[model samples]
Target: MASTITTDLKNLSISEPVVIIGSGLAGLASANQLVNKYKIPIVILEKESSLGGNSIKASSGINGAHTTTQSNLNVNDTPELFFNDTTKSAKGKGVETLMDKLAKDSHLAVEWLQSEFDLKLDLLAQLGGHSVPRTHRSSGKLPPGFEIVSALSKNLKNLAESNPELVKINLDSKVTDIKVEDKKVTGVEFINTQNDKVETLNTSNVIFCSGGFGFSKEMLQEYAPDLVNLPTTNGKQTTGDGQKILSKLGADLIDMDQIQVHPTGFVDPQDPESHWKFLAAEALRGLGGILLSPSTGKRFVNELDTRDVVTEAIQIQCSKANNKALLVLGEGIYEDLKNNLDFYMFKKLIKKITLKQVVEDYKLPITSDELAEHLNQYSTAAKDTFNRPLVVKNLGDEITSETNVFIGEVTPVVHFTMGGAKINTKSQVINKDGQILAQGLYAAGEVSGGVHGANRLGGSSLLECVVFGRTAADSIANVN
Candidate 1:
């Protein structure tokens, strides 16, 4: 039922056992666990009328080291290996202990979402920077972050209906301020979007699952000045409301300068405000796709480099090619690598009208002989045991004949901050004074920081939400 608070209720006081702000995966997962385990009466305040925050727009899947499917296919992976790979992906800056905890608990998180939450996942193809294949995703080739959030939202609603002592949801409500008393949080002040009414909710605990400040101009200027001029794909609501609150609360921040630039996001080269066209997943490159520079008509960088390296290389490739940027994919590549990749992303690009138009506009050499030579060189260079082939080295006038190669250009857009409200292993938000702010006040998901260190791995954000979400619940249940 669509519900709204009227002007007469502007000063209403809602007292709950616990109050959670934000309805993303982190908030929903933590609420679900808390209500199920302790029967805690919780109120979830969400700015959007519907659930799933920025997660609803995710185009990628969660990364994990589950051996269920990939292991069955003889792809060996262990928690230790997963940890090491994640650190390596972050250029050795990730917190070792934190990554270890995530890897160790990832299987259980996956299990809970699948068995208890009714979320589905398929093994996603490994991308550049990892030694083994371990991405897990839902159907729709859509980002499983959305699926997980949607599933947890349903669970929250069900719990609210059946267990009167458990969770309650208030949508179209924005948390305007957090009320603090004597260094302890007492409640939150929220404004209803449907009407201009404001209400104060008193609670013993406050959990922030609001996402990063990807869409906040001030945050971009402060943390990621280099990307201030580029395009972004983050949701408008991802303006990092939680970060602003944490900053005001004097929370210590880390890695605010380290930002990941997703290279495949299609943005309007002319207008920066245009929504990021869905990014072709890096999984595509792992499945024999190619990254091409339209200016020089050549490929560059191993498609599998960490996002930083790939984005940097794309910039170099485009600069070298006279500032022209575009990507290409061979038709046969989809045929051979489709079954091994996300089919939705595959079909989206497979039948892309822009691709055909781009190909036509560039007048790329598509003859049988030219194609065969390019394939031979690409095949020869694509032979990395741990890395994808750097396609720029393989494209030549003499090369031609067989093999399909998909190419894409660069966005170099700063998407989100990898750092914010510092938290301990228990997901307790810590103050700059080196003490926990409140006994029951916890944070999960992107709002809680210190996990991704300098750079985040491909699918670790969602995994962080679920893993820490559960841990935060356990901690909150134990809170006195």
Candidate 2:
């Protein structure tokens, strides 16, 4: 099903190649996979002048199944465990078969990024909710999520150089409408956001990877009103144009209410842009980090709970105190998050000598020692509680609140839409009425639905790209 050279550029005055709707990781992964595997022509349409949508701004790493490193640690992990954890975290709303497929493919995705793309993976620490160490981070200090996208982008650039006809990337092209005939996508109508010029391109398939609507205040209020105005770490370009467009096309949307709001989003009132500067990945919590409610002067639920659970806990803490809670982090927690900490957080840490100093200076009631004693005691108890209930030790006063407490803002910011055009396991995009539009109209990455059931794990999105990318390519190649 490789695309044929059906149209000549000279005769049609075509300004682009096979049209792609967004320049984010999903869009880029699709283009890179197609070009590298099939030598198909591609045209990436980006609304902004620069590349890197919310996908590039991500700080958390990607989650894959257990690796060789985990094997050495004697950490027993299987695809079944991965699938179970994901579905349980998502409250069984996620599709089990799809989760199973992704679980099996996760490891290969990690391997491909490291072996083929030269991306270094730090498999030492695992993220939240999982017992085994499966989260793979980028080596050195680069943010885990962005490093994967950067590697993919770099590979795409090399592919473009090696094969000039493979891809034609156009920046500032914002798609407004998708043209359809007999319920099948045929072309796209867009405007050059830079010059205010309109353009249209004919294509057999259209992929929407324009990111989620996290940055749009109006949409956030409309969709998840509960989390409206809570600080978000999402990129400004994540306005959910792709999800909105698909909704208009009568796609089966699932789980709009299930939003994953991370516990920590750096907030600085003076600089609005810095309000949601950077996020410390949930991995720190999984590694014994404590979550504190500074206003209430107490620690709440486990920080390692599923994102929604943590969000609810934070909201309750805020409401009970009649104000937004301030998050406290110990120096150990700060050290682990140093690489991905945003400018605001980095400055906050630099000015404060220790986690306790931060609380005293900011006039926050919580301190680090109190939070740490809680975590250390909890960690010791957790070892025996799940298997056998242990005698609880009181850790309230032994340690003062020295942990750094930043004001907590947990609202539903549009992060990523896990739902999209219906696609089979092989990644073939289907129509609204469950009809196959075209043989080669395949989709991978975030544009293809069913990968994530309701909510996604911290690092699973990037893994989806590589897993489905290769699957789509191979399926196309094998199809007659």
Off by over 4 Å in 2: 1-17, 182-185, 272-277, 320-323, 333-338, 341-351, 355-359, 362-414, 437-449
Kindly list the per-residue Cα lDDT of model 1 for residues 1-480, writing each as its tens digit.
334332222222423467788888888878888776676667889998888887665545676675565655577778888888777766655456777888888777877787887666755666666777777776443356667877888888887788645567889988887878876777788888888677887666788888887777788898878777666767778888887787787776666677677766654345435545455566566555566666545456677777777788777777654333554555545543444334434434333333335445556545445435444565555464334544433233333333233444445666656877888888888887768876666788887677877677777777888888878878877865
lDDT of 1: 0.68
Candidate 1 Cα errors over 4 Å, as ranges: 1-16, 92-94, 139-143, 162-165, 268-275, 320-325, 330-360, 363-372, 380-410
Assess candidate 2 and give its TM-score to the true structure.
0.82
**RMSD, one per candidate, in order:** 5.1, 5.4
Using all chains and alpha carbons, the TM-scores for the candidates as numbered come to 0.84, 0.82
Q: Evaluated with lDDT, which candidate comes out highest?
A: 1
Alpha-carbon local distance difference test for all models: 0.68, 0.61
Q: Write the per-residue lDDT of candidate 2 for residues 126-183, one digit (tens) a residue.
A: 5556656687776477787677778777877676677656666778877777777776
